[model samples]
Target: MTVTELAFFVGASGPVTAEGTEVINQAIEVQTEWSTRNAPSMPQGRENRGVSFLQQIEDPSVYLLTAHWASVEEHNLCIAAPENRETLSKIPPYFQVDKIVYFHLKDVAINSTSGKNGEISILQSPIISVGRLTIAAEKRQAFEQAWNEVKGILEEFVKPNVVKNGWRLEKENETTEEFVLVAGWPNLEKYRDFAQAKDFERYQSVLASFAQTRDLKCYRRIL
Candidate 1:
């Protein structure tokens, strides 16, 4: 799957306000509505599998749109259409254009999907934890090795939930530092508790140390 991630951060000059956020929500809803339509401009045999709008838990002003496509070519064709391009352009006012991280990810490897309880699977998990680690280009191999080795260590923290956590590389980007990490959990409280624990830092230290910048945020699926 070609997963396209678009993180929209709050505009620098504009103050975060309820009215402005409502406008932003309405603008994004337009894109969501368009993706669900069966329009001729859409590729013949390909269609979007899912399009979700996620609100950042720590910062309500930030939002993420995760869209799943069959391939990069299909994704390119869809957005190049005039109408779809215009639909996407409606969202820029709500975000800092330069800060937005728009990229594609491939070769995703996530953990088991069985729920923490019984029925609530990873997809059904209330929070999706996304961590973007910007590694120094030279440290890529060491970073990947360190992260891969700690998967078992991470699993130890999964007391109840499915250990649906793994990493993926960017499918298309000029820079090589885009390593996207994802995990699933029931709520913010559970994640925060574990994040503060020494075990998490034990596994996370090397990964963070290798990266020039690390951004970690938990998001609630709103789509």
Candidate 2:
């Protein structure tokens, strides 16, 4: 099973600057270098794979990095290594380590034979996804139709392996209703291509008239 870790970079006291950027880069470099060299010698589960970085629009200073792993043990090993220990010592200077959350992500679509309801064994962590939508009151039905149609298209046309899990919720956050899609792939390249595929274009077209904008976020899971 594939595991995930969400790392959040929250500035401890001041604004992030050029100096701060360099510091952060150096820290990552040191940590990654050490992990690459030491992972193989560590216990079976704690080896290092690589980290996938992502940042949201709300705050540029605040960043998210997701590190994928062959297994939970390998993920744990990398974090506990000596290089990561040294890097941790430097984190407070540039930013505070908010918290580290861990997650055992499951492919809900693959496990769902009927595709009516998805069962996600989500680990209790900080990597929760929230989406907000603004739909006119008079066009509520129209909005729902659009969302469902797009979801149906995604389910039918896109390859099942491309999507890990899918969920639909009404009034999930405030006034927004969203159909959420989750995917787990060997690499980001596969997901990026499918997002730009023709079928995906058609799915988005269904919601084009009613959608104001779609906000997306990818968070690292830390526990």
Top candidate by TM-score: 1
Candidate 2 stretches greater than 4 Å from native:
13-15, 38-50, 98-223
Estimate candidate 2's alpha-carbon lDDT, on a 0 to 1 scale: 0.48
Local distance difference test, each candidate: 0.59, 0.48
| Clashes (candidate 1) | 0
Q: CA shift at 121, candidate 2, in angstroms? A: 25
- Residue-level error in angstroms, candidate 1, position 165: 6.6
Error of 1 at 30 (Å): 7.9
Candidate 1 lands at a TM-score of 0.70
**Model number with the top lDDT:** 1
Q: What's the TM-score of each model vs. the native? A: 0.70, 0.45
In terms of TM-score, how similar is model 2 to the real structure?
0.45
